[model samples]
Target chain A: MTTTNRQVRLAARPAGEPRDTDWQHVEEPVGEPADGEFLVQVMYLSIDPAMRGWMNAGRSYIRPVEIGEVMRAGAVGRVTASRHPGFAVGDHVSGTFGVQEFCLSDGRGVTKVDPAAAPLPTYLGTLGMSGLTAYFGLIDIGRPEPGQTVVVSGAAGAVGSIVGQIAKILGCRVVGIAGGERKCRMVVEEFGFDAAIDYQSEDVRKALREHAPDGVDVYFDNVGGDILDAVLLRLARGARVVICGAVSQYNSTRPQGPANYMSLLVNRASMTGMVVFDYADRYAEGVARLAEWRAEGRLTSLEDVVPGGVAAFPETLMRLFRGANHGKLVLEVAGGKGTGTVIGEGGSR
Target chain B: MTTTNRQVRLAARPAGEPRDTDWQHVEEPVGEPADGEFLVQVMYLSIDPAMRGWMNAGRSYIRPVEIGEVMRAGAVGRVTASRHPGFAVGDHVSGTFGVQEFCLSDGRGVTKVDPAAAPLPTYLGTLGMSGLTAYFGLIDIGRPEPGQTVVVSGAAGAVGSIVGQIAKILGCRVVGIAGGERKCRMVVEEFGFDAAIDYQSEDVRKALREHAPDGVDVYFDNVGGDILDAVLLRLARGARVVICGAVSQYNSTRPQGPANYMSLLVNRASMTGMVVFDYADRYAEGVARLAEWRAEGRLTSLEDVVPGGVAAFPETLMRLFRGANHGKLVLEVAGGKGTGTVIGEGGSR
Candidate 1:
């Protein structure tokens, strides 16, 4: 067992995009589990667009990660020591364990996982928070009907990719909006999306008009800005806009709203926000359904595991903002067998 | 009966705020009602902010008034010539009777009103589209609970005044936002709003922080733009923003969206738009409930009935854009006892 736990902590809040100086690295001796607590050796740390929001000094769906605290994150790990009745040593589990090599938990908000059923990193990706977020936001909020047009921004990213696939599974015509040609092709070809809009080179409004000629019935918005405005213009009557995240606006000094919001009035539509944590009680059902889909080979879980361990946490997180990371971006903390499954640069598995 | 019908027609679409050239007054021979139709002697015309949107050459909830067509309007009239089985002669009725002294209708989307039960102008104000708008937008969309903070913009205007009153009636803490001191005073004093914020004299965000200290739960937005952005900043968790109208942006060449829309995601709230026409079937229920409230003295129906009849149609309609009209702005076409009830210059009855 490792004697020292190297952790990354928030040194300061960033004005725009986070800088290297905003993070501080330190090593602390691994501590033993308390009476009811278990000690975890974090295998993979989830890097997400929501992390940028957590670095802010204000309120969000979840409390912001305070400066000088271990940067809050979700990670899948193996229990090295256990005192809690719910956890056993060598068992795989996932929880809100900060960006560190070792995490101590009382089993609160932690769920046990079977590594034999799925890869360990898959627990941090599709079968975890990202999967749950996509499931609830798309199913509960988006409510895509069969044969309806379902459009999603950030379609190549973690939550959005899963959202598009789930929307497809629900028998909707899925159209993805992503940055590059590679991502657009990957979404359409690999993810089974009906069509994909290359927002990088093509005009999103024009592309959407051609692809979704009937207009978007369900728009799962992860990137809120001009793309959101484009989707607003093509909304069908009584359309549902599911607000998942706003990665595009997270770094902006001033976030600009969807200028075509009046489209909502004209179409008699609604824009609703969703937080995955709100549906925490029903996560087991979501996991079971997602697991069944994966087992049947109908759903694919793609994970982008960057291998420089916890020390590379800050840089790995920056990849999300730059649209550099494909699939579910994760920091491979323990350098386990999970990092060995590198199907491609695009992280298709 | 008059042989000539004086009518207001749309000559051209406006570039920005409507110019005088956009309207043309003409006289036409009064045509008799054909089989299954009725001839209505228009008594009062309802002028609304939505009129500005109707003149634009594009799609909205309804089609725009075509060039050279008699301006579209909602009016209270007496059926002078009836060939329809449903309507009788001398019956007071309300319908989309164009801006004219005499209008021919097949009685579709037309309802008979009781002039003796209430007042003639109230049918075009409180017991009309504005009343139904406030009812459904507030109850169905806003869903204000008792003790929840309900905020409304354009509080002195037709729909907004009733919205604040309805929220107050639902046991909510109501805050009204209007352009002037007199309007603010009218909302709080006569309309029974808990408080009022003069958007013209005070910073709306600052005023909202003081008035809606617990945060706004249901925001009934009538004048969207800066006021919409201001309210977005003060939204409570799970707030419902009901988009009824955007009078402030209706005339703008390019409507600026609410910049703080990310607040919806941060607060896990929703912004929904509604057109009252969608609730046409339930208008009877809304009118009945509103009439009961008016009879019990729990609700006040204020009307700004502008004199000078049909000839003053253009100028009377301009009052809505200038925020000059108090309560529901109506054009009194026929010299009647209803216009004699000008309780105040600010129109607070």
Candidate 2:
């Protein structure tokens, strides 16, 4: 193994859509793990749309990653070396390991995952931050009841795909809104969603009215802007709108607000914003439940793993904004193997 | 007394602000009470900002008034004749008495008010729907805590005035946002708000930073639009934003969405919409508490009773949008006397 580590660092905050020039690809010598610390070889890097928001210099749920710092990201990796009692060599762990081939951690926020229970990349997708976000934001905040109509935007993405499945598990009639026909098909046919609205092709408002005839009881919004306003107009009385992520607005110079927010008043609804980190204390509960659901064939975990080294990090992350990736967009490191690209088995899980 | 009932009916739906052509002034013979109904002589008409919303053609908390229908309003009146066993001829009562000299009710939604406990106009202001709206919205939705900063827009209006005083009673550091220096002074000095933001002359965002240095824990938003966006930027972690009214955007062809709503995600806050009618079952609870506060001199009730009786309904209601009314804008019928125009006494109550 090479003793050199490669890292993607934030070079400059982009005005709009981030470009390759906005990142710095650099190399550094791998450092040894100190006491109570572990060295991780990042195997599968979770490329999320929130990465765009983190690059901006402003207040967010978490502090903005400072300029020149290694680009922050969530990743699943194997412990290469460990001085911490909690981790051992070959132990699979997931954490905010950033965009790098090698990571040094104190094992503070890192949690061990069993590679046998689910695929390694699944840890970065349905069984990790994405899953937890959907679990809490939907069940806890959205408060979806049985027989209720639940609509989700960006429904084929990491968080939203899982959100739709969870809503189905809870006996809700799931309707997904995706950018393309392929994603919409995958969500409905493969992910057990009752209906799909191709926001790019179909009129989302009209489609929602047809599919959700009783009106949408809960809206799990990943894409904000016009999609959010459209969902706002279709909300049922006393509905709950879970503001999970605004992927549609993150790349824009100005994030569009939901002009139809008065629908909240007309329907006596609520819009609440949530961050997955807030449920850290209950992550184990979420992971266990998701694992059981996957075992029961009731949950679909889809991951779109791009086969490229860490050098392709910048371009790979841009696929989220371009609507090119169908599921969880992940960057598989060069040396990483057995990172499970299990497709069409047990319904795209 | 003249048996002619003069009414202001809706002639047409206005494109933006209601014009004189939109109202149809007509006269009719006063109808008598039926077996279970009571005939009321409307003494104090409550002209509210919500009147603008009611004129709009769409789904709201209540049905929109059709063209040629009597303009709906809440008013305090005396029971001139009662066929209902629950009410007496001399009793003072309040209900959806509409914009007219006389009203007939079956005693279903009407509630008896005490002119001796507080003045007749006081029932239309602090002891009526305005007070109940502020009470439930602020207490239940905003959930302000002691020592927390509670910021309210439309701070000198009917609902906003009560919201600020109630926040103070709950030990919250209250900040009111109003137009012009006169109303700002009234909110801070007369209504006992800790500070006031004069939105006309100052930058709301910059003013918020100075007045609510600790960040706004609860935002009681009555005037939604740019002001709501500004407050969204200043929200504290886990803040609660109460969507009371959007008087500022009532006349706009398209309501402006809050561009800074992502602050909700960053702060893990919630914005909820509430209608006072939702708490109709608990009106007694709110009324008892507000009445107690008024008796204790902790709550201030301000009313700007515009003369010219029911004929001034349209023009008096316009004062709310123009920011001309300092407190609760009301219309006193010509025959109505002893309604108590106690200006600046007991701190604008």
Candidate 3:
């Protein structure tokens, strides 16, 4: 068992995009599990757009990570020691374990998973927070009906890729909006989207006109800015806009709103915001369904795991802003090898 | 009977805030009604912020008024000649009669109202589109429950005054936001709002924090700009924002989007757009309920009627943008005696 735990802590808030200097790496003696507490060796840490929001200080859906605190992250880890009845040694578990080599927890929000059933990294991607978010945001807020055109922003990313698949499974025509041609191609071929819009090269509104000629019925938005404005213009009557994340605006000093939001009035549509924590009670149902689809060869998850473990968290997180990494970006702390799946890099599965 | 009909036609589309050069006055011969047609002598024209939207050349809920065409308007008039089964001479009717003294109609979108039961101007105010807009937008879209806090921008305007009253009738506490001290006082005293915020003088966000300590449950927005942003930041969990109109943005070449719209996600709230015309089938239901409330003295309609015939329409319409009108703005083409109601000055009934 490891006696030293390496952790990443926030040194300062970023003005725009996060920089390496804003975080500090720390080495600490591994914490021992007290009575009713369990110790975990974190295998992988989830890198998400939400982490940027967590770094900010203000009113948010969740509390901001205080300066000098371990930067918040969702991770899948194995129990190294157990003093709690709910957790045991060798059991794979998922929780808000921060960017650390090990975590000591008392079983609050910690859920057990079977690594034999799915890959350790898959538990942090398709079967973890991303799956639950896409499930609830799409099914509850998006409410896409069969034959509806469902457009997803951040189409090559974690939650968005799964959102498109689930939308297709529900009999929707899925169109994904991504940064480049390669990611767009992977969104179509690997994620099973009907069409993909390369927002970098093409005009989103004109592209939407060709792909979704009838207008978008359900728009699951992750990156908010001009793209959100573009989708607002082509919304079908009584359309639903699910505000999932604003990754594009998260780094902007002046966040751009959907300028054409009046289209909601013109189309009699609705824009609703969704937060995954609101669906905590239904996580089991979401996991069961997602797991079932995966086991049946209907759902697929891709993990872009980076090396360097905990200390590399700050740099790997910046990749999301630069659109450098694809699929569910995760840092493999315990894998000790180049083990992330490469599915979204053009024609590759 | 008048042989000549004075008309105001659109000469050019306004770049911003509509200048006098954008319109042209014309004297045309009164046409005789043919088979299945009727003639209407327009009495009062409804002056609304929506008029500004109709001048813009783009896709909207309704088509823009074409240049050289008589500017579109909702008017209450008395039928003079009728060759149709649904209409008779001297019958009071309401329709989009334009800024003209005479209207030749085939009775497609016209509805008859009793001028004897109410005043001629009331049909264009509380009993017309203004009343129906307030009814449906408040009840159907806002959906305020008992004891909930309802915030309304443009609180002293036609639709807003009635919206506050309807929200009050639904057993909710209402806070109104309007420009100027007199308008603010009128919103509280005449409109019976629980509180009023003068956006011209007071800080809207700080005022909201004081007035709506528990946060706003329903926000009926008319003047959407910084005020919408302010209210957005104070929304309670599961709040609903009914976008009735963006009077502030209608005149701008570059309309401002609500920068704080992401607050919808933090509160798990929704922002929905409401167009009064969508509730056309339910107009009778809305009017009936509004009339009942007025009859019971629980509701009051204020008409900021301007004296001067149809030729004064261009100038009279500007009153809405200037916030010069206290109540429902009406361009009186035939009310030669300056008989418009005097309310909403301050501390008046």
lDDT of 2 by residue, A1-349 (tens): 4578899999999999998889999999987789888788888899998899999997788889888999999988878777888888777888999888889999888989888888888998989888999999999899999999999999999999999999999999999999888999999999999999999899988998899988999999998999999999999999999998898888899779999988888889999999999998899899889989999999988889897778899999888988898888889873345334211112210
Better of 2 and 3 by DockQ: 2
Worst 10 residues of 2 chain B by lDDT: B340-349
- Which lDDT tens digits does candidate 3 get at residues A179-281? 9999999999999999999999999999999999999999999998899999999999999999999888898898877778899998899999889999999
List the candidate 1 regions with Cα displacement exceeding 4 Å: A337-349, B337-349
Order the candidate numbers by TM-score, best to worst: 2, 3, 1
lDDT of 1 at A153: 91
lDDT of 1 by residue, B1-349 (tens): 3578899999999988888899999999987778898888888999999999999987688999999999999999887777788977777899999899889999999999888899988998889999999999999999999999999999999999999989888999999999988998999899999999998999999999999998999999999999999999999999999998999988899889988888888888999999999998899899999999988898899999898878898888888989998899999887384233211112111
lDDT of 3 by residue, B1-349 (tens): 3578889999999998899999999999988889999888788899999999898898888999999999999998877777888988767789999999889999999999887788878888899999999999889998899999999999999999999999999999999999999999999999899999999999999999999999999999998889999999999999999998998888888888888888889899999998888988899898899999999999988988888889888889888888899989998876534223211111111
The lDDT for every candidate, in the order shown, is: 0.89, 0.88, 0.89
Residues forming the 10-long window of minimal summed lDDT in candidate 2 chain A: A340-349
